[model samples]
Target: MTVVFAALAVSRHLQDATGVSIQNLVRTLRTVRSATIRLGRHEITLALDIPAAAQAILDRLPPRGH
Candidate 1:
């Protein structure tokens, strides 16, 4: 969820800067199937399936021109 939120925020920023829609930004990210995060100390590892996460974010966004 946190990753999705961060992605959404970045998409929003890119939209503002590039005149692109959030949907487009997210769609471009669909190629990213997964990501790994490494944490120190505990050596925690987190894997994210980006397509699913992108879809989840897209699901929450209102349709364009709303």
Candidate 2:
């Protein structure tokens, strides 16, 4: 759900609502690493250092429709 994160990363309300943790988001901001993470019609190119757990969740998400 890279798209979701890209959105959530900007939303203070959403960040509070979901309680989703992105240590990667923090790391990326600090270290300036760049990578591409895509979902559905979205392609996000950010320097976010995604944690293993978040990466796993992204990997496990089903594409579009079953």
Best by lDDT: 1
Clashes per candidate, residues 3 or more apart or on different chains: 0, 2
Say what the RMSD of model 2 is: 10.9
The models' CA-based lDDT, in order, is: 0.63, 0.55
Candidate 1: stretches off by over 4 Å: 25-66
Q: Candidate 1 lDDT (Cα, whole model)?
A: 0.63
Q: Which candidate ranks first by TM-score, i.e. highest? A: 1
Model 1 residue 50 distance off true place after TM-score fit, in angstroms: 23
Worst 10 residues of 2 by lDDT: 12-21
13: Cα error in model 1, Å: 0.5
In the range 1-66, model 1's lDDT, one tens digit per residue, is 999999888777667655557677657665765545566655544565567655554556566665
TM-score of 2: 0.27
RMSD of each: 11.5, 10.9
Q: What is the C-alpha lDDT profile of model 2 across 23-64, one tens digit per residue? A: 543443344357888899999887667566556544543465
**Which pairs in model 2 have colliding backbones?**
24-49, 33-47
